[model samples]
Target: MKKTITIPLGSQHISLLEPVRFNFSCENEKITDVDYNVGFVHRGIEKACTEKFEYKQVGYVVARVCGLCAITHTMAYTLGIEHILNIKTNKKIDYLRILMLELDRIHSHLLCLAHTAENSGFEGMFMKIMGDRELVMDIQEAISGNRVQFDFVCIGGVNRDISTECEKLAFTNLALLDKKVDDLIGKFTSNWSTALKYKNIGALSYDDAFNFNALGPLARAAGAAIDVRAESSILPYKEVGYKMILGQNGDIYDRNLVRLKEIKNSILMCQNILSGLTEGEILVKFKGKPNGESFTRLEAPRGEIFYYLNANGTNMLQRVRIKTPTFSQIPGMVEIFKGSDYADAPAILASFDPCMSCTAK
Candidate 1:
């Protein structure tokens, strides 16, 4: 006779920062079925953007959608509005926008790597990554005046300009971060224990990734070769030397490697932006109300984040819609949980870097 058991990894857990629940049906340590819920932290930000806030204020409101990727959300919303308003921002504004966006990506990817390490019983690696992540955070604060919700991007242009001090600070810190991240890549790839916890675990094949329409590192790690930065022209990602990083095996290890490589790529992009800094006004005054519908897409740290806006040539918008990456990847995530050991669930979940706040919003 065979025995089967069920395990639930919570709507709240020490390993998770946000509210999400997963139930695993296991037979002799291998998972046979999986279920998940991502609605614990829904705050109705979409409704509030249309009902309560004006077009000018909705950018800031959407920035609160997820602190880690706040800059991405703000940039997406601002791009949609700029498209509707037909604002031709200068090159300097675009450069500065890409700088902040890359900085945000660096820090967000580090946090995800740290969380994955901690879940894999690598507390020391987690501490090292977190400590080094502060370098990027400091640069963010210096540039945008805040760590998480910078509110840097606006409808016409950026809210602030890069000063000489900020430029030097960014260059110096990125040099330091480059070295630390290289060390992390070494540890994640060469260390046997880390490889054991991560390699060949929670794998999603190329077929599965395509079938599920997965995005971000999850899809890239599976060799899906789909990246919004490469596909979408909404941002000047190509001007900043954007390259899509892909992996052959879709497992936790590959996911970590993809993120590490992306961090290096983001650092290079920031350096490129700073080196080619042109002179222009960071903010421009526009005198018309947004009167049409617009949509914009950008590559957030986790995946593609999209914003849709409908305006009626008034101060207030008629509708605001957000399609976050985590929400779209839930089906893929559930599929990965199947056929894996129940004990490996936490590490697998961490590798996906699921953001419940972004999903439920």
Candidate 2:
């Protein structure tokens, strides 16, 4: 019998962007069993949201759950509160919210692609993708007045409207970013390191994905048709040309391809949103505290993010619960680690784009 040894990937590792730990039981170089820990970075954000912050203030507070998807968190929390309050947002508000969300998706996906490239020893490609990601960040800053943590969403609607200059900046930068993404699609497909080597590494089967309850691109990459954007009507996703991009294999290559294709789709949706901007107020005035319980689901860059709120007709909430995609996909991620070479763990982990902060919160 081959000797079995255990190795730990992270709680703090060079290959990890988050504080997640993975223990791999390996026989020779093949991973035979896998265990993970995602609670290292927990900050008690949920506790604070329900106990300290009021209903209106919770939107900005929840935005701190994850820097990459700050807008997603805020939007989900805002929508949940709005649902309890019976607030009806107009067309322009919906469009603006979607615009910020797609832009957030573009930047987040590019960051994941960059991380995957770096973890796979392609530092040059990583740098290039990061540079291209700045275009999207610039557009977001122009619109939201912040780069990473955009507290742009509120209870009823958005905090700001797209101005003429911001619109011009969006059109110009998005046109350039679209061309760069096309080039990236070509490189990701043809490059030996990003494409061939990653083809069958760390693959998750469709059945495994379904059985494990995978969400977002992780599930879609495994041939599982799961996406909150397509399933939920919380936003006007269908009106803004939202398409669910899927891949046959759940390997690193397929995950990278799924993200690249989604970035292209998000860019198109952003353009469509800008071109079809409706005339209305971004933020609508409202009163009365939310008394009932409400929940919302949104498709974040990594996966589906869920928010549940229970209010007691007061300023503070009784309970605030968040079910992030990475939290749900941990089992699916561990399932993929088995039967793979130990050397590929970094690349595989990066492809999942696990957000520990969001999960822990």
Candidate 3:
């Protein structure tokens, strides 16, 4: 006969960056059951978007949902409002938007990888990756004048245009970051601890991923053919040389590799956007209050971020709803926790890159 005990891992654990709680049922060293909770950091941003802020101001408010994914939140909200108003932006707006988006993805993925390394006891690698991540952060600051919570995207367009000097800086820094990413690929793939120790740890099968509706790198790491970039025409992703990346084993190692490849692909897309630059207005002036409901989806670094907006012929929106990737993938995450080693919980959690703030918002 075997005995089981329950252990709690969050809501304020050192391993977590935000407030999320997990209770594990364990027998000896192995986990037998799991319970997850994520509302500790909830700030009522969705309610504020409808009642406290006007439609135009909601973009800025929602941008605070997650600092790592501010641009995506603003973009998704803006696109939803634009859809309701039936406004079609020009090529230059689309190109510049894609540039910021890919840059956001680059930094977000690097941060996740660095945390994963740190969780696995590779402090040196964590520091190296964090240091290199500054390259993309600098580019974003040079373009938008902020490192985090850029407030770059607006209801009709972006806040500013890329200057010649800024574009030159982006090119130079991205080239350097490209080389750094190649080196990271080598380290994550060939290093003994990062590569071997991660093998077969916290794995999710392809069928399980599909059944649970896993999104972003989690699903892609399990070889599930699900990606908003490949499925939707909401943005000009296909025009900017975007390609879907997939992994075979669905383990921690596979998830890390998938992010590395995505970083590489995002670099390519940013370069393409800059190379095929167009000339036009970044913002379009429109005079009308929103009157209908609209839904929009954008691929954030973690996965597909969705927005729903409803307006009743006024400046104040009737309702605002957000469905984040982390919220959707909770089922898949709980599934991965079962039968995993209790000692591996932190590393496995880090590998999933759960963004509790975004989920709770």
The candidate that wins on lDDT is 3
Clashing pairs in 1: none
Ranking of predictions according to lDDT: 3, 2, 1
- Each model's RMSD to truth, in Å? 1.3, 1.1, 1.0
**Which pairs clash (backbone N, Cα, C closer than 3 Å) in model 2?**
none
Residue pairs that clash (backbone atoms under 3 angstroms), model 3: none
lDDT of the candidates, in the order given: 0.90, 0.90, 0.93
* Model 1 lDDT per residue over 43-122, tens place: 99999999999889999999999999999999999999989998988888888888988999999999999998888788
lDDT for residue 250 in candidate 2, whole number 0-100:
86
The local lDDT score (0 to 100) that residue 293 gets in candidate 1 is 99
TM-scores for every candidate against the unseen true structure: 0.97, 0.98, 0.99
Write the residue-wise lDDT of candidate 3 on 177-252 in tens digits.
9999999999999998777789999999999998998999999999998899999998889999999999998999
| Candidate 3 residue runs with Cα over 4 Å from true position | none
What are the per-residue Cα lDDT tens digits for candidate 2 across 1-361? Answer: 6589999988989998988888899999999999888899789998998888887888889899889999999989888889899899999999999999999999999999999889878999999999999999999999999888888988788888889999999999999999999999898899998888899988999999999999888889998999999999989999999888999988889899999999999999999999999788888889998899987899999898888899999999999999999989988888888898999989889999989999987
